[model samples]
Every structure is written in C-alpha cells, then in structure tokens.
Target chain A: MIGRLNHVGIATPSIEGAIAVYRDLLGATVIREPFDLPAQGVRVCFIDTPNSQIELIEPLGEASPVHAFLKKFPQGGQHHVCFEVPDIHAAAADMAAKGATVLGQPRIGAHGTPVIFVHPKSMGGVLVELMETPKGDHH
Target chain B: MIGRLNHVGIATPSIEGAIAVYRDLLGATVIREPFDLPAQGVRVCFIDTPNSQIELIEPLGEASPVHAFLKKFPQGGQHHVCFEVPDIHAAAADMAAKGATVLGQPRIGAHGTPVIFVHPKSMGGVLVELMETPKGDHH
Candidate 1:
C-alpha cells in the first residue's frame, strides 16, 4: 500500500534556475546542491519542506528521459509524484495484477532505495513512482 | 514562506476512474467521496496519504479552468501543486517583491482556506497554489 507522499518531481532545463524560484523566491531554505545521477540521466536537486520534498531534475544527456519532456515544456513542469510503498516487489506484483504497467524491475532510485514506476496510462496520466519505504523510515 | 505540501491537484475527466486507480489499484485506503465545489468550478475528491492528500478534480462546466486543460490532455494530468504558507497576505507580498505574478487576490480555495496562485511562468512552468496554513495544524 502507498505510504507517505514522498516527493513531487519537476523536470527543468536548469536546476539552478529552479532553485532560485524555490529557494530565494518561495523561501525554501534547506536545499541540497545539484548532483548528477548518471543512471537516472539527471542532474538533481532537492528542496526539502516540512513534510515532503521538491525534486528539480535537469536532463543530464541527450538520451535522458526528461529530454523529451523538456522539449514539450520548455519552461519545464511537474513530471511525476512518488509515494512510499512498504515493499517494492509486492507493489510491482500489485500493479501487474491490477493491469498497471511497471516501467521495469525495481531498481535503485535517487533515494538509494528500490523503486519502480507505474506508467502514466495506468495512473490516469500521472507518472507515479513507487519507492520502497527506506530502512529505518517510520513514515 | 511555504510550509507543508497541502496537496497536489490532479485534473481528471472522471473522479470515479481516478478513485479506482488510487484506492483499488494503488491501495490508498482513506478516501473522501467526491463532492461538488461550485465556487471552484470543479468536483473534488481526496485520497488521503500518510502525509499529504491527492486531490482529484473534474471540471464542472465549460467555463471551468480545467475544461481547457482536459481538452489538451483529454486524459487529464497533474494540474497544480498546493503548499501551505504561514501568512497568505505576507506570502502574496513576498511573491510580488520576488516579481512572481500572483493570479489574483487571495481567495477561498477548495480547502476553504485563503489561497492564491502564482502563474506557471513564475514557478518554472508549474502552477503553484499558496494556501494559508489551517489553524492549529502543525506539520
């Protein structure tokens, strides 16, 4: 079952520009510096809030998945929402049983935890990432 | 300043279908039945997660803002992200000082709280709604 609302992903052309908006303008103070996740094909930054996080991601290369998204939305936009699940493999099975398409086998996500994506078609046009509840995470 | 993520507003053509995906398929257990919010020009349903809520919205009339979004997406999509701010008036002033466009004066939102929207042009092409934190609610 879905647990906490983990974070909302926003695909942007520049993480620094997105940081300016979220940090200086919106007053988000605790922010993580941009870091590249070659496997995820993104230069990612995290803006932490009281409850969840705002993930700002920029395409790291031409083959990055967000490359096409950035083309469609030049100024970038909300890309997906991630929720914590108790178990990754079980969640994948649940998705399959319910006729939802899991993007691939559970893989390590930016959080360093196992995660899988349910296609937007199955989630009603929302790309939903199911992240296994991190070890020691109470929520 | 932004506080908790109040909710993510998802525009959907059918609240029932969205509910089926969130509740039955995704195992989201606590769900509030759909209700009409005529002033907001949409019917709303809430899927409660441990931390935040997922708001599913369906345009109530042709004049509804989401009506235009549905035309472009047909299948609906993530419409906007709402965050709680400590003081609505101050937040609006801050947005103004930051050169962010506030759509209009703070008005009552679906949550019955004063909320104002920043144009997508300002929030990195993400429509952001700032709502006054509900009374006595601690994140």
Candidate 2:
C-alpha cells in the first residue's frame, strides 16, 4: 500500500529560476541548493513544505528523459507524482495484477531508493512513481 | 507563506475510472466518494495519503475549464498543485510584487476556502493554486 505522497516532481528549464518562484514569490524558506544526480541524468533541488517537498528537476544530459519531456512541454511542468510504498517489488506485482502497466523493474530513484514507474496510460494519464519507503523512514 | 501541499489535482475523463485506479490498482483504502462542486464546475473525489491528498476531478458541465483541458489531452492528466497558504490576500500581493501573475482574485475553492491561481507561464509552466488554510485545520 502507498504510505505517503513522497514528492511532486516539477521539470524546469532552469532550477535557479524555479527556486526564485518558490523562495522570493512563494515565501518558501527551506529550499535546498540544486544538486546533480548523475545517474538520474538530472539536476535536483528540493523545496521543503511542512509535510512534503516539491522537487525541481532539470535535464542534465543529451539523452536525459527530462529533455524529451521539455521538448513536449517546452517551459517544463509537473512531471510525475511519487508515492512511498511498503515494498517496491511487491507493489510492482500488485500493480501488474490490478491491470496497470508497470513501466519497468524497480531501480534506484532520485531518493536513492528502489523505485518503479507506472505508465501514464494505465494511470489516468498521470505518470506515477512507486518508491520503496526508505528503510528507517516509517512515514 | 505556503504551508502543506493541500492536494494535487488530476483531471480525469471518468471519476469512476479514476477511483478504481487509486482504490483497486494502487491499494488506497481511504478514498472518498465523488461529489459535485458545481460552483467550480467539476466532480471531485479525494484519495487520502498520509501527507497529502490526490484530488481526482472530472468536468461537470459544458462550460467547465476541465473540458478544455480534456480536449487537449483527452486521456486526462495532472491539472494543478494546490498549497495551503496562511493568508490568501497577502500571498496574492507577495506574488504580484515578485512578478508572478495571479490568474484572478481569490475566490471560493472546492474546499470552501478562498483560493487564487498563479499563471503557469510565470511558474515554470506549473499551474499552482494557493488556498487559505481553513481555520483550525492546520496540518
């Protein structure tokens, strides 16, 4: 079962520009500096809220999927929503059994935890990511 | 200041179909039954997660904005992300001073609270809603 809404990923043309919107405009005070996730092919920044986070992501490589997404939505937009599940493998099996198309096998996600994506077609057109809750994180 | 992420709005063609995806497919147990928010021109259903809610919305009438969105995507998709604000009035002024366009004046949202939307163009193409945190409903 899904435990919590982990984070909402917002693809951005420039992480610095997005940071300004959240910090200066939205009055967000807990933004973390942008960091590169080489394996994920994206630059990441976190805007922490009281109960969740807004992840600002920018394409980092020639073949990064975010680049393709940016081509479709040139200005960048909400990319996907992630939910923490009890177990990634079991969640994949459950999704398959319930008729949703699992995009691929569980792999390390931006959070450094096993994660799998469900195709947007089978999910009402909203791309969804299922992540294995971090070992020590019960929430 | 923005508080919690109140909900992520997903525009769906069918509320019943979206309900099944969250309940049967995603193993969500706390799904709320669909209800009409005629003033907002949509039928709404809430999928409760520990940290936030996933709001499934379907166009309710001919003039609903969701109809325009559905015409574009057809299969439905993420529409907007809503964050709770301590004061909607002040938030609007803050956004104006910082160069983001407030879509319109704050009005009654689906949750029966004052809410305003920021133009997607000004926020990295992410449509954002800022709602006044309901009295005594602090997250």
How well is each residue in B1-139 modelled by candidate 2, as lDDT tens digits? 8889999999999999998888888888998878898877999999999889999999998799899999998989999999999899999998888889998899998788999999999888999999999998856
Mind giving the per-residue lDDT tens digits that candidate 2 earns over A80-112? 999999899999999998888998788998778
Which lDDT tens digits does candidate 1 get at residues B52-121?
9999999999999999999999888899999999899999999999899999899988777899999999
Give residue B95's lDDT in candidate 1 (0 to 100). Answer: 97
Worst lDDT run of 10 residues, candidate 1 chain B, spans B130-139
Which candidate number maximizes TM-score? 1
DockQ, all candidates in order: 0.91, 0.87
Best by DockQ: 1
- Cα shift from native, residue A42, model 2 (Å): 1.5
Q: In model 1, what lDDT does residue B29 have?
A: 96
Candidate 2 docking: what grade?
high
Model 2: lDDT equals: 0.91
In order, the Cα lDDT scores of the candidates are 0.92, 0.91
In candidate 2 the C-alpha lDDT for residue A37 amounts to 85
